[model samples]
Target: MLLVTGITGHTGKYFLKELINNKYQGVIRCVVRETSDTSLLDNSGLNIEKVVGNLNDKSFVEQIMPGVEAIMHIYNIHHSPVIVETAIKNKVKRAILVHTTGIYSNFKYASQEYKNVEQKVFELTKQKECPTKVTILRPTMIYGDICDSNMSKFIKMVDKLRVIPVINKGESLLQPVNARDLGKAFFNVLLSPTETSGKVYDLSGEKPIKMIEVFRIISKEFNRQTTFVSVPLSLGELLAKSIKIITLGRINYVEKVQRMGEDRSYSHINARNDFGYNPMSLEEGIRIEVKEYLEAKDIR
Candidate 1:
C-alpha cells in the first residue's frame, strides 16, 4: 500500500491529479484533517482510502504505518521528523518527502524552524542501520492556479491595483516552480526510487527572472498599463511595521518585504539529469494562472 499526506492542499492536489492521469494501479491511502475538503478525491475515479487524523499524533501515525510500503509526504516540512521516525520504526521501505528551498533563506525568523526540522529528518534517515530509503525534493515558490497562496494573491493585487510597490526597484531574482511541474516531479521520483533515494533535488523553474519582469509579465497578461513605485529598503520596512501595528498584528508584511530584496533562485539540473524533470517557463505558467483568475472572476 502507498500512503499520501496533504492530499487536499495546493501541491498535493496536483500530485493526486498526476496519479489519476497516469492510471496508477496501486492502492493509495491519504491522511487528511477532519475539516479538510475531500470533494476532489471523491470525484476522482481512482480507488482511494481516506483516513481522518493528524500526523503529529504518534499513535495515529503508527496505526496507519503497518501495511504502508512507501509514503509520499507532501505535507509541511515541520512534520517530517515524526513521519520519518515512525516510518523507520514500522520498517517502511521507501519514502519521498517534499521540502522547500526556503531553508536557505537568510531570514532567521522563517528559515530557522525549517532548518531544524530538516536536520532531524536527515539524522534519522542517515542512521547506520536505517532501512528506509528517503529522497527529499526541495521546490522553489510554487504557483499554478487560484489555490496557490503566493502568486495568486499577487495576481489579484495586480488586477485590482495597477500600482505595484517595490523595494530596491524589484531587482531581486526569483525562480518559481509551477505546481503542475512539481506534481510530475513527485510522480517521476516515486517511479525511480533507486536513482533518487539518498539524494536531494532542487525543483525550480526554467530560469530565474527579475521581480520587475514578473510584474511586467502579469501586467502584459492583463493588458493593463501599470505603474511601478520604488521604495527604499529601510523605508519599506518601516511602513510594513507601521501597518502591522495599525492592524493590531492582524496584517504582517515585515518578512515579506524583507524577503523581496533577497534572491531566491535555485538550479534543477540534478533533478533533470536523474529523473528527466522539466518544468514550464514562468510566462507560460503565469498565462494559465491569469486565465484561471479571469474565468473565476467572470463566474462571480
Candidate 2:
C-alpha cells in the first residue's frame, strides 16, 4: 500500500500516472482537500481511494498510515515534520519528501522553511530508535504544462503584452526541471529505497539558461516579436516592495524580483548517479507546455 499527499498537484498527478502506466497494482490512497479537483485522477481509471482532509490534522494523518509501505509527500513542506513523525509511529517503512532546490538558491524565508523541514526528515533517519527510512528529493524550478506557475505566466504575459520586462539583463541562470521528469525521479527513488535512503538529491533540467533566454523562449512560443525591456534590479525590487505593501503582504513579489537576479542553477549529478534522473531541456519542455496551453485554451 502507498500513500500520496497532494495527489492533485502538478507533480502528484504525474507521479500517479507513472505508477499506473508501470502497471503498479498496489493499493494507493490520496490525501486531499475537500475542494481539490479530482478530475485528473478520476479520468485515469486508476484504483485510488481519496481521503478528504487537511494535512495539519495530526489524528487524521495517523488514521491513514496503517498498512502503508511508503509515502510520497509532494505538498507543503511545513507539515513534513508532523507527517514523518506520524508515519514513524505507524511503522511506515519508506518515505519520500518532494522538496525544492530553492533551499540552495539565495537564502530567504522560503528557503529557510525548506531547510527546516529537510532537517526534520534527516533527524528521523538518525533516530536509532525508528525503523522508517526517508529520502528527500529537491527539484529546481518545476515547469511543464499550463498548470505550472513558472514559464506559463511568462507565456501568458508575452501573449498579451507588447513589451516583456527583464531584470538587469536577466543574466541569472535557471535550470527548471519538467514536472513529469520530477515525477519519474520520485518513482525511481521509490524503486530503490535502500540505495536512496537517508540521502538528498537535486533534480534539475538538463541545461541551464539565462533569464532573458527564458523570456525569449516564451515570446518565440507565442510567435510574438516582443521587445525585451531591461529594468534596473533596484527599481524592480522597489516596485515589488510597493506592490507587496499595496496588497497588504498578500503578494510577495519582492522575493520573486530578488530571485530574478540570483542564479537558481543546480547540479543534478547526484540525482542522475543515484536514480538516472535525466530531465528534458528547457526549450523542449517549453514547447510541450506551449502546445498544452494552446490546446487547453483552444487557441491552436
Predicted structure with the largest TM-score when compared to the true one: 1
Best by lDDT: 1
* Candidate 2 global CA lDDT score: 0.85
The residue pairs that clash in candidate 2, if any, are none
Clashes within 3 Å, all models in order? 0, 0
TM-score of 2: 0.94
Task: Give me the displacement of residue 127 in model 1, in angstroms.
Answer: 1.8
lDDT of each: 0.91, 0.85
Across residues 1-300, which tens digit of lDDT does each residue of candidate 2 receive? Answer: 889998789888888778878877877899988789998777777678888988888889988889889999999878889889988988889889888888875636688877787887778767878878888888888888888889789778877898878998889898888998987888889898868987888888998899888888877887889888899989999999999999999988888888888898888898888778889878888899988888988964
Provide TM-scores for the models. 0.97, 0.94
* lDDT, residue 201, model 1: 90
